[model samples]
Target: MAELLRNYVAGKWIAGNGEGTLLTDPVTGEALARVSSDGLDLRAAFDYTRTSGGAALRGFTYAARAAQLSEVAKLLQAQRDDYYAISLANSGTTKNDSAVDIDGGIFTLSYYAKLGATLGDVHALRDGTPANLSRDQSFTSQHVLTPTRGLALFINAFNFPSWGLWEKAAPALLSGVPVIVKPATATAWLAQRMVADVVNAGILPAGALSVICGSSAGLLDQIETFDVVSFTGSAKTAAKLRAHPAFVARGARLNVEADSLNSAVLAADAEPGTAAFDLFIKEVVREMTVKSGQKCTAIRRAFVPKDHLGAAADALVARLSAVSVGNPRNESVRMGSLVSREQYDAVRAGIASLREEARLAFDGSQVRLVDADPAVAACIAPHLFVIDDASHAVRVHDVEVFGPVATLCGYEVATGNSRLEEAQAVELARRGQGSLVASVYSNDDTRLARIALELADTHGRVHAISPSVAQSHTGHGNVMPMSLHGGPGRAGGGEELGGLRALNFYHRRAAIQGPAASIDALTESTGKVEI
Candidate 1:
């Protein structure tokens, strides 16, 4: 039996005649499905959105749109199992990881739905007794958010198909705009499957949602003003996309969440056998192996006291080695394979480059795994690198090994304000290497607060983990609806908050001043002309 992949456009299921693109099971390397993007109506899809679908979406109020999103969330929750089965083929992730990506996406939709209903204004004006000039005078202001006229183009990474698509789409929908999702070729079948479900539900208006499974096909060149384009991939690709003629000219709200050298720093007070040490080891290993370390927010660097570096590295390797790797269907398998052979090769190349500034503390190449089909299996074990020169440009920061690999950097601090003291602290700060998220394990409130503020000005978000207050549900891979997700510099200075902030990106803000009644009427509807 062959898997059928369908594209949703103008609120209908449309099939194409393109040759099938193979979809393989990560662990066993067997064909799970085949997808194609040939014959897809790229131009027609855009036209339909701008003309028909965009009008329908814009016809609804923010509260009405939120109600629709809540309904879709319920529909998706019922189909959770179908999504899980398909998700297993891309990466043999455990049920928990899949839930975070799949159901979490649904939760994100629900969250934004509630925000849309409660956050926006309801009425026009009201009379008040206390006035600046007269007793009967009234003052009023309304915060009205309208959808941007152009479409929101989404360029998604392959790791979490469901989360990546929904995280971008939820806000666009809530803001009364249409979306065009472009999923990466390697793992797009999972996304295709989910979109099929959404289309079948028949809630979204025609042209309101569209999907392109293959090349962006000159879509980047067509973006116009008030449009938003978001990409989740490498910095190199992001730079290229940013340089697109349309993006440069229109400055269409481009949001790029690129891969970076994120890190976790352990304080000197955290020693072995304590909760902090255990948490450190768990965090490092989980980041290295989850989705085969394909996450953009995965920890790339581990910083520890010079004395604890060896112990921490060894503990990390030991934890990783015990994680069983095989088909996710097997209950014992804790880790899975990379999405494809090409991704595995790229990760391997990155690990090989670390020889310049770091040494392999524990080699994953020696680890054993069972692959039924070696030809199709793109499998590689986790690799660890221990950094010696914190200032080294290439290995310490420049390169990002997007796989089950990590580097451990150690630093020694001296008492008082000496040159060595400055060097040690500076080295840790530099070791961050343009990260998306940097975390510190410490119990000292004063030091934690200082570090949080210092890194906040530098990194996107700083996590100060202490025994007193920490949530298991929180991880580097997770992006909350309230906070900005992207980091500065190498991580791509763009964001996706999935809240009012993300919604605002799809619209523009302008202030008009005149008589209060005229301003209020103009703000509500443009149909009422002053003349």
Candidate 2:
């Protein structure tokens, strides 16, 4: 029997009371650990954070809170190798994939730390300068962002456990909001372990951060109007969370980063052998194989010029063919298994759904494993579906396989008469409802600019790449702290990162109109001691 992973309640690490649920190793199909959060005092946990955690964090200035984050980042980075080893067993991700999550989390912490430190010591962030409202300038109106008087509930998905938790926590904590993290049950061990490390380091204040590793029963019921909830998962789950009575009726804050059917396009003017075309193929292949295409930002569809579809397909086949799939523990393996057998089955179901409107461009059932047995390992080869008549392929747009899978759609270029105009490409991209990102590969300055603008409303981020800038481009799926990373409709209309803007999720903005002395007293702008 695997040892039970304990949940951190209040300030203590306590073993779950229920017969724990088993967590399996993806590559070997063996039990790795057991997780549970039964027989826990749900109300007490929330209250502990609300009182102890929130109070302690509220005591610090923004810069002091950020400085604490820097300490946590340094502690985690020193032990990153341990996280890498653990991820190899549970996630079946290579060192590179683990670094993207583990290292990326540290980087995010540091980024937010620096951002907050630069703001100096302040209890509240003042928005712009106070405006003069009175004719004599005695009265003015000012806007300020202040931390919510409650805790933050972060419910993250199975993939990128460490990164998901840290990315949300960094901002929430900096905003002086305590956090209660509920990681997806399957990969909660990593999150639990990371929290345990932070606790052991004695960096964060008591009850400032907690992780519960089991069902979220009664969890949503505990949230109130002042609390903020940030979720990362499927669209369906995002909707359910958004509809929670506490959020829907009480008006609690909710920021959801759901999986989107993001797309990448090849410039209509690019020839088959051009650098732009080659970069497109490389980007797709990388997204497909990395973490076995489990990233929320992974490309789910590729748009190519009709005349160049065959060439693009051929190039993709060559690149994907060379990818070696096996246990992530093997140095030779390039791609590895899905997180677990359950996730493997889910991806299989998604693939079956895709077959209704598209043919298999790259067969996945048949593949060679480098250092593992295909019969027992929870692994699937990269899959490519070709949309023969994209105009009517509703399933291709509506369905997302959420694994190493994508649909290829063709849009004809101008040859005296352009079969598919840039407007049509934008229309095809919008069929996804909304997405986290959409990338355009084009050399035509006019066409790319129009496509980018048209896509701006539909996607959280728009990435444009050509041979001229492709060399320096950050690739199609990369998310930066300086940019907004959420979109509308199906992708969940929430925003994150974006520098100081991210702090908005954990803050309340209010406008005050009053005399200058009163305004100065409320915001402490007159230097009568900061709030």
Candidate 3:
């Protein structure tokens, strides 16, 4: 029998009441573990963390909490090889893909550690300059931000269990808030192991970090008005959470990063042989194949000039054909399976729906695997579709396949003007309702600037690639810690991970109105404030 994973809650490791959900390897269909939280006391867990854990964490200043984060990062770095192995078995990820989650998590923790040091010993931060409230200037209003007197509950996706946990935990911990993580059940092994390691190391206070690795049945019921919930998954799930009684009636804060059909555009001025055009092809292929194109920010829509649609399709197909897909254990395989069979079926279904309007430019369904069975393994070949007329394609814009699939769409150029083409591309991208990111490839500085500005309101980040920055630019799907990572509208209308900006979500801002001397004393004090 495979080991049953245990939930870490209320300073103890406990098993659920009955037979739990079985977790299997996507590539080989091997049973890995079982997980459940059927009988756990969630109300007690929340109360303990909020009162005991929250108080202990809030007792430390920002710099002291940052030191603890650095130690946690170091401990994870020392054992990352084990994490890589777990990721391969649980997530069906190649070595490179594992690095993106494991290493990315460690790096985010370290980045926040260094950033938090600059905050010094302050517990509450000054929001802005004080304003005079009275005519004599004797009274003033001073805005300040302090940590919420509650815990942070994280509901993460299966694609990135490790990074998803730490990316939110780093800021919440730095801001003196405890964290309760509930990783997706399909790939919860890595997240459970990481929490066990940190808890055993005693780097954090008891109940400071916890993981519940099964059904999220009663987790939201324990939340109060001061608590925060962060979720990353499908937009359908996000809507349900928004309408949950905890958020609607109790006023608990919720931040969501949901489904996004991010796009990439090739400039009209760049022909087939130009450097800008080549760069655009490379970026789109990288985004589609990376993590089997499971990233929320992956480019699902590729827009090019209508005149060069054939050339773009040929280049993309050629590049995608060279990619090898199978089990990640095989060194020759460039891509691996989806997180589960359910996701594989969903991706195939999404592709079928897109075919109603777009032509199948490249069919990878018959590609040979390196070392896995095509019938049993969840591996899928990279697929490319071409929509000659993007204006009529509804499913292509609205649907996200969430796998190694991309649609190559063409934007019309009726006026023979580059400016008009750029506008058309932006309009097509906006049809997705909203997105996490969009990249524009152009050597022309004026065109790149115009499109980027227009895309700002819809996308959280805009990546502009030219020959000048091609060598140094991060890939379009790569979410950096220094930049924002969420978008508006269909992308979930939330913000996260822009250096210090992430801490804002975990804190509560209040304006203190009092005498000028009293306000000055509040700002000058370096002591921790008891909640």
Top candidate on TM-score is 3
Error of 2 at 320 (Å): 0.9
**What order do you get sorting by TM-score, best first?**
3, 2, 1
Count clashing residue pairs per candidate: 1, 0, 0
- All candidates in order of lDDT, best leading: 3, 2, 1
Q: State each model's C-alpha RMSD to the native.
A: 4.6, 2.5, 2.1
Q: Can you give the lDDT of residue 462 in candidate 1?
A: 76
lDDT of all predictions: 0.73, 0.85, 0.92
Model 2 bad stretches (over 4 Å):
414-420, 520-531
Model 1 misplaced regions, further than 4 Å: 1-4, 120-144, 370-375, 417-433, 471-473, 519-531
| Deviation of model 3 at 510, angstroms | 0.4
Q: What are the runs in model 3 whose C-alpha is more than 4 Å off?
A: 414-420, 526-531
lDDT of 3 by residue, 1-531 (tens): 788999999999999868899999999999999999999999998998998899999999899999999999999999999999999999999999999999999999999999888788878888767899999999999878889999999999999999999999999999999999999999999999999999999999988999999999988999999999999999999999999999999999999999999999888887899999999999999999999999999999999999999999999999998999999998999998899999999999998998888888888797898898887888899999999889888998999999999999989764654455667888999999999999999988787887799899999999988888988998899889999999999999988899999999999988899999998898675433322
The digit string of per-residue lDDT tens for model 2 on 1-531 reads 899998887888888887788888888888889988888898999999999999999899898999999999999999898898788888888888888889888999999999888767778877767889989999999787788999999989998889999989999999899999999888877888899999999999999999999888889899988998888888888888878898889998899888699989787776777777787888988888888999889999888877787888888887878888888888888888889888889999999999888888788788888777776788899998887557687887888887899888887554556534655567788999999999887766666777788889899999988778866887677677778889999998989888778888888887889899877775553111111
lDDT of 1 by residue, 1-531 (tens): 557466666555666566567777776767776666677766777777777877888887677778888887888889999888878767566676688779878888888888767643422111111122323334433334446888888999988898898888888887778998988877888788777777778788877888877656677766877778889998889999988877778777898888677878776667777777777788888898887788888888887877777788789878877876655666776677788887877877887788766788778777666543445567777888887546444556778888888888877755676523324533556555556787777655565665566566557777777776656537655678777777888788877873567766776553343345654565444321110
